[model samples]
Target chain A: MPATSSKPRLGVFKFASCDGCQLSLLDAEDELLAIAGQVEICFFPEASSRMLPGPYDVALVEGSITTAHDAERIQQVRRDAKFLMTIGACATAGGIQALRNWGNTAEFVRGVYARPEYIRTLEKSTAIADHVRVDFELRGCPVNHHQLVEVLAALVAGRRPRTPGHAVCLDCKRAGTVCITVARGQPCLGPVTQAGCGAICPAYDRGCFGCHGPARQCNCESLVGHLVQLGHDANDLLPLVRNFNGAAPEFRTVSDRLEQGWPEAGGPPPERIPT
Target chain B: MTDTRTVRVEILSRVEGEGALHIETRQGRLERVELQIYEPPRLFESLLRGRPLEETPDITARICGICPVAYQMTAVHALERALGVQITPEIRRLRRLLYCGEWIESHALHIHLLHAPDFLGYDSGLAMAADHPQEVNRGLRLKKHGNQLLEVLGGRAIHPINVAVGGFYRAPRREALQRLIPDFEWGLQAAIEATRWVATLRFPDYCRDYHFVALRHPDEYPFNEGRVASSRGEAIDIDDYERRFAEVHVPHSTALHSETRPDGGCYHVGPLARIALNRDRLLEPARRLADELRFETPCGNPYRSIVARGLELVQAYAEALDILRDYRDFQPHRIPYGHREGTGCAATEAPRGLIFHRYQITADGLIEFAKIVPPTSQNQKQIEDDLRDWLPGVLDRPDAELARRAEELVRNYDPCISCSTHFLKVHRHDH
Candidate 1:
């Protein structure tokens, strides 16, 4: 059915993902009804049965491009969308599934499927921006519900979404959480990960594992050095850096460097990790 | 009139993940039904190899967002069994409490937002909220309470990071868990009211004998522990799950269809199954309210799964409050375990239904093999069977109306395609 409303049309798109990030919009328990009141939710199939034909005013794309059909499908989404925003680690970064980028995708298929011939997938799961021009990107393994609501509210209000690009350390500082890394020699990713999760892990007295992906100025070299001094090996640090944000450029470079050991004189590594 | 018609719904909405349904009717007789799950496979098992055992729960939690804690719970229990670790009693309570949070969140979302629209003739929960504002507001409040509980315990609702192999990463303070008491108390009564409200909806005349399967515990309503029990009196241990049940790839769906190991027959799992197998075990007032509503045992109608979800929601909130009131400070939040080469398996009740996870770990604690049979995969063949039985009665309707009804039938299961596609494969016997 055509949405005969004058309000701005919002379209939610998915690629290959857990559906957690887009769910953040629904997880906005208090704001969801109010959100429905404001914007005409024109094409969110997860929340609505309505697949209103869109020249969508704003499109929030979740997941990452992993299949040939979805790859072409995204181009159509880009064409139909006036303004596009990529949400969550899968769209902003390539998600944990992007770990397939390092391994043989064919082998990955063969291992899981009885007849690998039937399954069709791309060699790698790449970020949405890698495929098309994205006006904005929100980062999280699952984007924070509050941030999701803010982005939707901003899009409706015709303003830039005010999601800060600071590291999780800033959030930890604001919450007055004692740095687990400094106190207990834990290998915390808070110094490099983006802030939006409100430093929840450290607040629970655990090390941040970078679910929110990379912050603007992630000094991976320095963070790695500090962890090494704290009696953690490269093996301990590699998994932390590579996971979730493994395909993000900043985390990817450091992970590559970690995989290839450092020089005797404490210099950068000699080679890429060969993705 | 067209004797041969195919009602194809390319995209099923108001459900988790992605799927399409195709139904065929020939001469007013139901011919075939295919629930095509075109959601791209992530191949999590293939990728899981060589990852450390510690990461299993966290990594598998990404399979589905709505039921992340279900994946995590099954993973941790399976992995812990592999490593020969025993958890403290306190850890067990916390784990159960965390699961209650997921049940409330997942069930509440499905009932109010996804499934209720089918009963009331609305396209979306957002659209339904227009006239039924009070009901919608109650749903939101109920959903938020679940999220709040998750935040206090598991860290965040979607894919919480706190759950580890043997236990949680950190034990929450008694004060922290106690804070949600007021909301939970209100939520239990609210859930009962919700159940009462949904019970009033007029149900379609569709009921048939189903081989309802669920986890059955001797003492409690099963969550993390039980032997698999069915309405046909079949009971088996979790380790024997693969021996009794198996998955076969259909050409159409990215998700494999599950069937009985020997018979290749469809069986049902999820809310209705759980209720059929374990309704007597439910704590009051959820149990008492079931009597009040005159809820049937072994309810064959899948559409009435919403009532079962509502009852479960009441049970979740009631149980959650019980745990919250009893919770006190506990020591050794994460139990210590050393690496050894062994294989272990577990079955747990996801909000959707029963899920199974098995693992073989290296002596060094890296995963050697991993297998996950999520609830939706297990339910797919059964869904197809239901539609085959269902399509004939509604065959006279035009394709558009047929598509609408078919989509409603699929939503009854609340299928999560993302989880089902993770370990799917084709087994074309006649090829």
Candidate 2:
């Protein structure tokens, strides 16, 4: 939906992730004043106390639904927002805290809090899309500032956001960076993860750990097979895929396959003598 | 006949966590003041058990989004200790520069956004900004420089990936660092002015004889390294942190309250503590500004903490410039250290106060036990003490004035309750 009014009313909402993504918005210090001037910033509790009741024009929602209150809140936000964009891994796919979704919630809760009886939470931490509709998703552990600005501009101008839906391998290639996986035998996640963080890990002479979630065309099977060929066994690949973007469909599928002990999708496990 | 009253203050404003103050009054006198932390308990230690040692830096950084670098530094220091790795001089300089970014950013955040509102009598920063745009803009610009430096060096401002166990995964180029110097020079001037501006605020003349505790380095205002020291004649190395401080669990709140070990009394941390303990170590401009403002040593007044934070911002800017001037390029280090089975005790100044992290690692480099004491948790008892002392005089004031002043008192510490643990539970005295 286009902002028919003079300025778009922006609202930033948080639910269950580490508040890093929202901090990114504030981190846009040079551009922040200009951005504030361009929009009506109706509700951003983290930044402002003067919240104008919304019917917000656009909502840049961070975090995931982890509690009964959050479930209700997300629904209310969706109703209030004309166009709701989920920001970061937590809003699209549950965050690192979503590791709880795989474990027992009651036990996890008991292990964490002293007054367990006072705590109120759900069994699983799920994304905003799991409950209400998310018009678009910005992928990353902490969404890139430049990309965030682009997304906001697009929403204001009534144009589809030009956020790269491409993979990290493409970014690495464009930056003229040599593959750590190919050269140094690092088990990089570049092949399956999204592009936004400018292939930072690879440029640093280390393998990409996939802080940005899975891209649109992730072929995790081939990547996993290649990593195994390079050196990593099932044990290494399990955790590699299960990090920041662990819950995304493509990565999760490959992780599940590795755990289930499937014999290389056809033939027996490749035998290699230890050094 | 014995008279008793329990005053409960829920959801303390101008601080970070969910905490309440419960004071028990018996026989027309103050009995017990327990600062209760009700923030949802996060088992960072327990969660870290099975995870690999390399993942500790990023995992621990999640403890506080605002001061992620503090977490990163402490975690990396502990890991380096466990792994038997020593970072090079160049790496140490870069680490200090990164830490200065956090200090500038975090201090600007508290002094301008969270703490300033209380001094100016506003609900929040945005409201205060509307009334005083230029002042707010100046703060934002100073904060911008800090963010810019962090982004250029650490890759991202929060939970930066550039820092690792041995050292930074990537060393920032000299050119990138040089580009920051001009803006930082401007920020230094602005920060000095900001210190003066903050000092001008009508600071409520309320002082306490707090046993201020902070990391004190002989040559510098402690950022990355220091020996823990206090106003009340207590100094110890990082290893003796647990011996000096003790954490106790109260029946009212889930979060534990920390105090001096033998005496078991509350002590304060953060700017007031840091500034008071390291007064002589402050940089030239900071020292000059402190003198001009007449912010003498042993500053126990909690309200002057904002002024102290502003002064620290100036010190941070100077430190940043010093690092920039002494810039040198170095090859990235990746010397893997052998992990040992032992406990690591470390304390670094987080933006809010002294953040202590102690972890027991297994031989295989996995965390067996983890205990973190954030600044806000440490200040709980001291906060209640301030309320108990001040409330008697203000009990006759209108409810609105009393509540406002109470909130202002809490704001003095610039408490990042979100980082530490918050509902302000005030146990007021009955006339």
Candidate 3:
């Protein structure tokens, strides 16, 4: 019945990260069937066996481009979809696996696998946008499922989805969560991190780990400087600033300086952090 | 004419991660089988190097979205072992409650959405949902209750952030957990009925011999801790896991295939294996459900695994209710610890199967090395072995039908290919 339907076709694809982001759509248990009714889920192998050849209406790509094969495959995905959206930190900023970009990828494979020769991977894990033009990018280590629903609905309605670009501090302020960085002297990146994940870490009585990459106009260096003045070590700042969004421009620029020398002043952040 | 044929499933659907199957037959003889996992490797073990020990739970939880609690629980246990730490009894109960939440979520998803379609002759659960709205909605509702438990206790469902090396970063208040009792009380019955509903589906007569393996604990159905036990009669301490099992890289897949050490043979994990090994330890209601279904111990049919997963759903829901109803918040939410350079290993029963983890940490709490043997990797070789045995029986069917049957057999494992370095995409070659 879905084959003959003219509903906007949605294709979900993955590359080099955990399947969490795509699962967010499924995790939206209340809205999944309703969304499926509106969007003909024509090409998500994770959910359906039917794999219709696509000139799809919407394509949601998860994970980073980390293999030679994936590097080429994404070009086809971009060509097939009218609107392509990258979901999760891996798609937008290379995810936690971006940690490998700092060192030797060959060594990384060798460290994990006994037969490194059997493994074939690129020198770096990079975001989907590095290889193809993306219409939208949803940021999170796993992404907020509620935002995912909003985006799917927006794309169908031909409207811009209202995703917050401000820092998570805004969310904490709205929720009235006490500041862990101030109240408990905990190292926090909420001031510089994006507003997703509903600002849960502080309410859990721990410092923010920055699951949702860098916020719009993130002042990463300024926040790091404040923490350093508060007696947190270089180690603390490096881990906080260079985490799931470690490869995002603001965080990466600040981390690169911290790697060179933190607590001591460094030069300005670069205009961009290339994937 | 002597028939020669080949079938390739280019992308396997209804499972986590990317994988495909390649099958070959020459003159009526099954020649080759490959459960190829093409999901790009993320290098989690290598990336974990030099990270703080406390971060292990959060970091390792990224291995699979469907089973992140398995990774988190295994990581925290292993990290605690490395640090020579002891968690309070209250914290231990909380960890079990968290795991129960995951089992409910992961298993409910697999049993109803991922695995049930095969029995009902549908391409997807959404397709099945068209005629079975009540059933599908009930399943998703049950799954959400699990997510709620995770949200209240572990901070969120996917990659829960509350788990730490010694214990939770914050113990959930008694009231927070108590609120879940009503839902869990309802879910326990829902899961029990769900098990009965799934048990009615006509299962193929596909019983075959298996060296079933899972964790075995004395007091309970194994979750957080246990000896690695096998239906083949091998039981060893979790520390001796590597001595018994080892992983090897194959040319066709990014996920490494694991084999029993020395013997170098495939072994099974997941619900079927776990049930075979630990049926006696299941809670009273679940054990009774198992008996009511007339499911004997060591059920060797892979197709009936949907029922097996249903049984565990009942077990998880019932156990979670017990914990939530008796909930209490405690002091020292995290145990303080001193670390000396040390190594540790732990095994926990994920919703899918038994997952093993080992780590070496520096005196300063930075991880020196980490090894995670997710359940799917342990079952990869076993799935391949099953296909070799299963393909012959379906050879009389048309090429497309054969491939569909083959894919159903693979799906019976509820394989979490994402966790393995891990689906079936099919091409048919005839000669």
The CAPRI-style docking tier of model 1 reads medium
Those runs of model 1 whose alpha carbons end farther than 4 Å from true positions after fitting are: A1-4, A263-275, B1-6, B26-29, B423-431
- Candidate 2 vs candidate 3: the DockQ winner is 3
RMSD of 1: 3.6
Which lDDT value does model 2 have at B361? 82
Inter-residue clash pairs, candidate 1: none
* Per-model DockQ against the true two-chain complex: 0.77, 0.29, 0.73
Residue B425, candidate 3: Cα error in Å is 3.6
Q: What digit string (tens of lDDT, one per residue) describes model 1 on residues B1-431? A: 53545455667898888888765555666666678888999889988898888888889999999999999999999998888899988999899999999999999999999999998999988889887988988998999999988888999999998999889888999999888999899999999999999999989989989998999999888898999998987788888899989988777877877899799999999989998999988997888998999999989998899999999999999889999999999898999988999999999999999999999999988999988999999999988888878776777777788778878887888888888985211111110
How well is each residue in B214-284 modelled by candidate 2, as lDDT tens digits? 99998988987889997877689888888889876555665556888898898998888898899899999
CAPRI quality of model 3: medium
Q: Chain A TM-score for each candidate, in the given order?
A: 0.94, 0.92, 0.94
Candidate 2 docking classification: acceptable
- In model 3 chain B, which range of ten residues has the least summed lDDT? B422-431
True contacts kept of 1: 0.78
